[model samples]
Target: MFFEILKNLRKKFKRLYITMFKNYIIFVFLMLLVLSGTIGFMIFSIGKMVSSEDYIKDTQKFFMASKIVKSDYKKIDASKIVASKGWVEILNSNKKVIYVIGTKKDKVTSYTENELLNFMDLSYNNLKSGTSYFYSVTAFNSNGEDLYCIVKVPPGIVTLNVDIAPSPDKYIKKAAIYILVGIFIIIVFLTVSVFLYAYLTTKKVVMPLKKILQGIKRMTEEDYSTRINFNAENKFGEIRDAFNFMAEKIEASIFERNRMENLKQQLLSDISHDLKTPLTSIMGYSKALNDGVVENDKKIKQYLNIIYNKSKRTVSLIENLHEFTKLDNSKFLISKEECDFCEFVREIVSEYYNEFEEKNFELEINLPEDEIIYEFDKVEMERAISNIISNILKYNEVGTKAKIELTYDNSKIQLIIADDGVGIDESLKENIFEPFVRGDKSRYTKGGTGLGLSIANKIVQKHGGTLTLEKCKKYKTVFRLKL
Candidate 1:
């Protein structure tokens, strides 16, 4: 429920903001109109209510003058005072008669004369106190210098005359003029306010968003570096942060993917190198065996043996390369089962006893009876170790004893495979484990692809270990595996 309320409030605020965006002029106009109304009431209407009191002040003034007369005057003719002025009424304390008259612009106005007389008599009653009195009225200049007439104050209510043009109904016209003036002021303020507000809002909000849109357009066109770096607080800041995060992720993903593709290409190049050399040697040997131009059984048997070995070497290279490919592609999952490392290597070497006999290759096995247990993937480790053995078997010629040593020291397992037959050339020792790089040119065309060591190197690396031809000379090549 709270979330709903917040959602509603957000929608409402957005609508208000959009309304401000779209019809700001109209809104400003309406605001100015309200302000003008307040100002108008203050200026022309509000205080005036107390000022005129609807002609009541005039009536009260008249009554006060008549009362002063009654208190001060002795017996005298009341009609003479009324006759002294022409059309004006004397508001005098020493006057003989008390009377009231109405005038405008120094001349008596005849409109509503009867109502005027009734009011005059009512004012006199508040003053006269039942004294014998006949009221008189006269019109006067604005200075009260002329006398007008003597008549019964109650009876002569309608005798006055007025000359005038139509008064223009000033009250209604004044109201209309005030209204028009108010509308004019409101229009001026509204127009200016709306124009300024529209300019500022567009400059601050709409223009920045446009810039962000332009950046997006650039990005859509494959400009990866396009950035929306707006320095803002509210909604615009949020937009910038979101875009930045997305861009960062995109760049990282692209970099990693490109790196992987390059690595795959490099792997293919290595495979070609290993396969081409072996197949070339195999072809030369197979042609020799097939031609059978040998003069003796001995040379022919040698040719056939070379062909068989070359074929085996090519097959082993391809298999090992495929295994490495699987590992590199994350298709293989290794298991962590404990095994006696010394026993494992010893037993594996023992399995190839017949091949050793046929090739007259002596195996020098050095191990301890104390079981060296280690955690590894069994089948994969076997392939890795066996590939190294295969490399030794292919490179070392007849009667060459291959040294196999396994030792554990200081909480680490180490395996050493060394061959004393034309080991590896000193200059090429460093690159011996690189894919398809055969170190000893003298040992070239012996019968094995060079990728064997590379696969072994990669597998050992995968096991959090290192395999290196640590040292090599003309007669000794030593490979050390530390796990």
Candidate 2:
């Protein structure tokens, strides 16, 4: 269970790494967005914490003390609550936009005219109870014109006069609006700056990194000749060093593996060639002796006949081995010719009918009548196709059905080969196409030199196409070639 959990985590991380971190640009963009959001939030929160409420009790007290003088905690005056026309100050009223009164107590210091209306409303609501007495206040300057607050001591009908300049709430509100606007502008600028900085920071790293990654991926996909050069002298230079190191290691490993594999194959080829030449000469001599030299000598003729037969069998085995070995060496390249694909296939199938029939292979062929031309090496295609056909014939039971299909669409050519045979086992299906692996290991009737499919794969790859085993089941196997 622990191993399974670890495996699952590794898979998930691998997928995420492939899909997400493959692009460094996105990582930088996210970093910019997150940083800007955090800074904006921090600034806004600080502004709120230090914010002054506009017209709370402290503000009202300050305004009152600054405006109303001589009416501070003194005897209550009456009979002047609503005489109108500066009834409280009685023609000394001149403060335009009075902010506070010189009242003794700090009860109603910060009252403005607008707030005066609401305060008056509240006092009137209380005084409407027909109380015996109440108090009120009003504001003015030496030349009142713009603002004031008026309050009444109802029932007693006393009015209080105040004189002071307006508070800074109006200007402060404007300043708040302006500051909010400024913060908004800063937000926009910061957002842009963050992303720009991110782009500037990331482009230096990501662009070259992406180029290197693509080059490395191409090389891994077997384009060993692809050259990538990304030079830097900083951290990216170190990363470049690591990447070049990895690429060098991979290239060296692939080169060594391929070199050793080729050497093994060449050794097999040379050994087979040497064996085949001598066997062919021996078979020729035995055949000549049996057919022409020993005609009527019964026992010697019989011996020569056996010798010829055995030599022929031995030669056939040697040739088969040589063919398998040749598949391994794969140094032979094709001379491509542009030809109509369908016509080429039709001609090859027509020529190979007797070979298919001799194996009791039920053959089905399909090809388009359209004249689609492509460049291909006929020799390579024939060898690949023949190996597949041979596999079907050797591995399948007698009277097994086989199919060859050719279809083209969207400028792509598809070749499909299907056969009903004892398909690969579920356990070993993945490895069956590897060199030297046979579908059946219990016997050697097929002489399954496993190099056949491997060579076919390489050939198709040479043609810029892919060959894949589409399905393998108990009754059938299908091979697909897509170009």
| Best TM-score among the predictions, by candidate number | 2
TM-score, model 2 to reference: 0.44
- The C-alpha lDDT values of all candidates are 0.62, 0.60
lDDT by residue (tens digit), candidate 1, 119-224: 4455333534343333434333223433222233322321222111223244456556666776677678768876887787777578767876786677677676
What is the TM-score of candidate 1?
0.39
Q: In lDDT terms, how accurate is model 2?
A: 0.60
- Per residue, candidate 2 scores C-alpha lDDT tens digits across 1-483 of 323533544564466456545556666676577657766775665465446453332234322322343333232231222232112322123333233222322233344445455544553335344543343444433332333444333343232222112255664676566567656766787688779767865676567667766875786586755555666665455545655565676678889899779857865774565456546766765766757765657856676666666566556555655655565565856679998988887886777688788878888889888887999988888778777877777777778788988999999999888888777666656765555555676424344545677677777877889888867553368888887
Per-model TM against the reference: 0.39, 0.44
